[model samples]
Target chain A: MDIFLTLFINGLSEGALIFLVSSGLAIILGLMGVVNFAHGALFVWGGYAYVWIYQMTNSFILGILAAMLIVFILGIIFEKFFVSRLYGNAPAQILITLGLNIVFIEIIRLIWGNTPIAIKKPDFISGTTIINGVTISHYRILLIIIGISVLIIVNYILKNSKTGMVIRAGVQRSDMVQALGINIRLYFTIVFAAGAALAGLGGALYAPLAGNVISTAGANNQILAFIAIVIGGLGNFSGTAKASFLLGLMNAFVAWFIPSFAVVTNVLVMAIVLAFKPEGLFSEGRKSILRLAVKK
Target chain B: MKSLREHIQRDFSKNVIIALSVLLIALLIFPKFSSYTMLNLLTRIFVISVFAMSYDILRGYMGFINLGHAVYFGGGAYVAGILYNKLGTTIPVFILSIAVVVLYSVICALVMGKLSFKKGTSVFAAAMLTLALAEVVRNIAESWRDVTNGTDGLIFKVPSILSNRIFFYYFSLIFLIVMFIILRKFILSPTGRVIIAIRENEQRAEFLGFRIENYKLIAILVSGVSAGLAGLVFGTFNRFANTELLSITYSTNALLYTLIGGTGTLYGGIVGSIVVNVFQNMLLNLRSIHPIFERWLIFLGILYIAVILFMPKGIVGTLRHFIENRKVKSDNEKSSKTEKAPGE
Candidate 1:
């Protein structure tokens, strides 16, 4: 029972982190039709930024804000210069984003050196709380709270706001959105930056929990985010949340029970999901999760 | 005068003969003229060229961008390594290894095709699926310690005949030449034409009663086998099989080489592989001069961006475009000159 409880909390926290990373990816892919392979690089950048800022300022909040801001700016620059040019070209987009990822990762290496950087949990969130004979870390609770709150805020914005409406509509039919007199390109840029900010937030929040951040962390997280998006239907927020949680729980449980298979579990789940439901679990009908090159 | 079609055919055949003779002469004399290091480098280039060309068939001809092509390449190497390790690298064992690697690659490609080429699947989804699948394979390679030795990798000896550098270089060179000829012939075949048609317009090809999936499958299978063959040569040359072979970086390299050489042009793979390999070698040599040269990946990343931005068609592709344009201009000028002379 104790093991199960611990696993459940672990799963939820990990799920929240995944959700943080994947939601942004899903939004960008859905609205802009760009895969944005450098999304992971942004996440890594955020972690590094958070760690560096936290060390300098001794304030987690300031670190998180700085991380998000830095990544958001980077996202705007990326969307403007690199991604904007390859709007309809899938191959070019993949190649360019992949190159950007390499560049970002190399830059991180140059800045941070090869060693992984560890960030300590804040003083207030340093201890554990026991409930019903199960001990849960305060940081884990904070992560869950922050994750749920962000999800709610994002959901509310998407459900009610004009920009959110434009983004949602843009995902469905950019041509129609353009006809409606909204600059879809501007919306794309905004959404991309917003997504990058979310990824940054995820990285910053995850750093304390994971204890350390490595340059390759971005690539690893990127793969997990891709798996989450694939499993949940791409572009579906609710689906992403559910898939992230399920995958996180599965990963936690698998790690506890059969440790050898932990690394393969995420990939296996993705493969199985792809085999059974290629459109993904949350997809409505015949909508392919990722639309390739849009024929002009 | 002969028809334009006949003239073009004659010219094409003449070009083919000249190219083949040049290739043969280069193959024969290259080792004798170059140092052992250069020969080794050229051998690597040849192997990579075969791999790139196979990739080109899918990306260039079929218009399918497979981001996980290293699966087959690495799969072949691992299979060869395992076989060689177990069977003592005898002639028969080597032959069997090549055959097994090809079969394994075909099976993998078939499975990937079935999963990704479904009725409404987009190209991005397919690429992602392949990437995911390749990562899974890499993980397996990493964890399957009993077979792969995990990250430590498998280092084994090839047969005595292949131990000599010059002999092995010539052996791989011959293998590359033979594979190149086979690929060239395959590309010019009727099936190749159908595959090109599918690339040009899948819907039109389907409407014209061609089985697009089947053609794609055939193209992938051919590509997989050739890639597997190249991997076998690579593994034999290095006498090692490691997880790095299964990496997405290698797949990226293949894409980079094929794209830089020009898609659909068979020789573009050769050109791209040569250019990239030589450039990489140069960068590696420069590392001794400056520690900053160790940051070769940054340069490679910039190169990829530049290629995508400036020369999407690649070196050979751009060159072909230029030559064709010049030829058309000359043709126009000659026709005008004839018309003017008659008028005068």
Candidate 2:
């Protein structure tokens, strides 16, 4: 019972972190049709920024805020200058983003060197809380709270706001959205930037838990994010969230049982999911999906 | 007197023969003139060129961008390494190793193709599936300590003759040239025309009564076999097969070389491999000049971006396009001149 309880929290917290990163990826891919391979770079950048700022100011809030801001600005610049140029070209987009991923990792290496840097949990969230027979860290609780809040906020914005409506509509019918005079290009930029910010936030949140941030962190997380989005359905936010949690739980359980195969389990799950449900679990039965499935 | 089209065809064939003879002569004499290090680099280029060309068969001809192509390359290398280590580098062992590697690659392609090329799989989904599958292979290579030695990698000896740089260099060159000829022949055949038609427009090709999936499968199998052969040569040359061979980095390198040289053109692989390998060697040699030279990956990244933006057709493709344009212009001028003279 105790093991199960611990695993539950472990799974949920990990799933929350994954959701933070992958939801952004899912949303951006859905709306903009760009894979954003460099999304993981934003996550790593956030972690590094948080560490650097935290070391200087010794304030967790300031560190997180600074990290988010820097990544957000970088995301905007990336979308405007780089991603905007390769809108309709899938191969070009993949290559450019891949190159950007390498560049980002190299930049991180240049700044921090090859060694991993560890970050301390904030003093306020450093303690552990015991519930019944199970012990959970304060930071884990905080992470869960933050994850739930972000989920709610993102869901609300997407459901209620005008910009959200534009994004949703644009994903469904870009031509119609453009006809509606919504400045669809601007919306794409915003969506890309917002996605980057979410990835950045995920990085900042995960830094303390990860203990150390390395250059490979982005590439590592990027794979997990890819798996999550694929399993959830490429463009479905809710599906991504649900898949993230399921994958997180599976990961935790697998790691506990067969430590060597933990890393591969996500890939296996993705493969299985792809084999069974190519259109993903949450995608609507649109003509595009049908076209993708049929050999014309 | 031949018709204009027949004359053009004869001229093109003649030019091709001349170009190929020159390349063969250069490769044959290269080892005698250059240092051992240069021979080794050229050998690497030859092997990589074969790999890149194989990749082009899928990416350029079939329009299926496989991001996990290194699985076959690594599969070949590992098979060769393991066989050489256990059974000794006998002629039979070498042949067996190559056979196994090629078979492995075909099977991998069959499974990956079935999963990704199913009716509704998008380009991104297919790429992602390949990436995931490669990662899975990498993880297995890392964890299967008894066989792969778990990331420390396996280093084994090849045949005594292959130990000599000159002999191996010639061997790889011959292999590359042979593969190039075979691939070129395949590309010019009727099946090749159908494959190109699919690339140009898949739906239209299917509507025209072609079995699209079967042709794609054949392209992928051919690609996998050639890539496996390249990897077999690479393993023999390096005498080491490690997880890095199976990683996304190597796969991306193949993509980079193919794209930089030109996608659809046969010789694009050779041109791209030579350029990238030479540039990489130069950068490594420049480490003493400045510490910034250590950051070569950044420069490579920038090159990728620039290639995509300005020269998407790549070096060979762009040059060919320019020459073809000039030829067309001259032909038009000549036709107009003849017509004017007749009128006058």
Leading candidate by lDDT: 1
DockQ by candidate, in order: 0.62, 0.72
Write candidate 1's Cα lDDT for A122-222 as tens digits. 89888998889899998988888888888899878776789877866676678998998989888888888999999999999988988998988897798
Give the range of the ten consecutive residues with the poorest summed lDDT in model 2 chain B.
Answer: B1-10
> Which docking category, incorrect, acceptable, medium or high, applies to candidate 2?
medium
Candidate 1 CA-lDDT value: 0.85
| Candidate 1 lDDT score at position A195 | 95
Give the Å error, residue B331, model 1. 0.9
Scored against the native two-chain complex, candidate 2 gets a DockQ of 0.72
The reply for model 2, stretches above 4 Å from the true place, is: A169-182, A284-296, B1-16, B342-344
Determine which window of 10 residues in candidate 1 chain B has minimal summed lDDT: B1-10
TM-score of chain A of each: 0.93, 0.92
lDDT of 2 by residue, B1-344 (tens): 23434634733677787897897798898877899889899999999999999999988788788878999899899999999888998879998898898889899889888778777677888898888888888888888888888899988988888788898888888898899889987887778889999999999999999998888888888898898889888998999999999998888888888889999887888899999999989988998999777888878778877887889998988988898898999999999999999789
lDDT of each: 0.85, 0.84
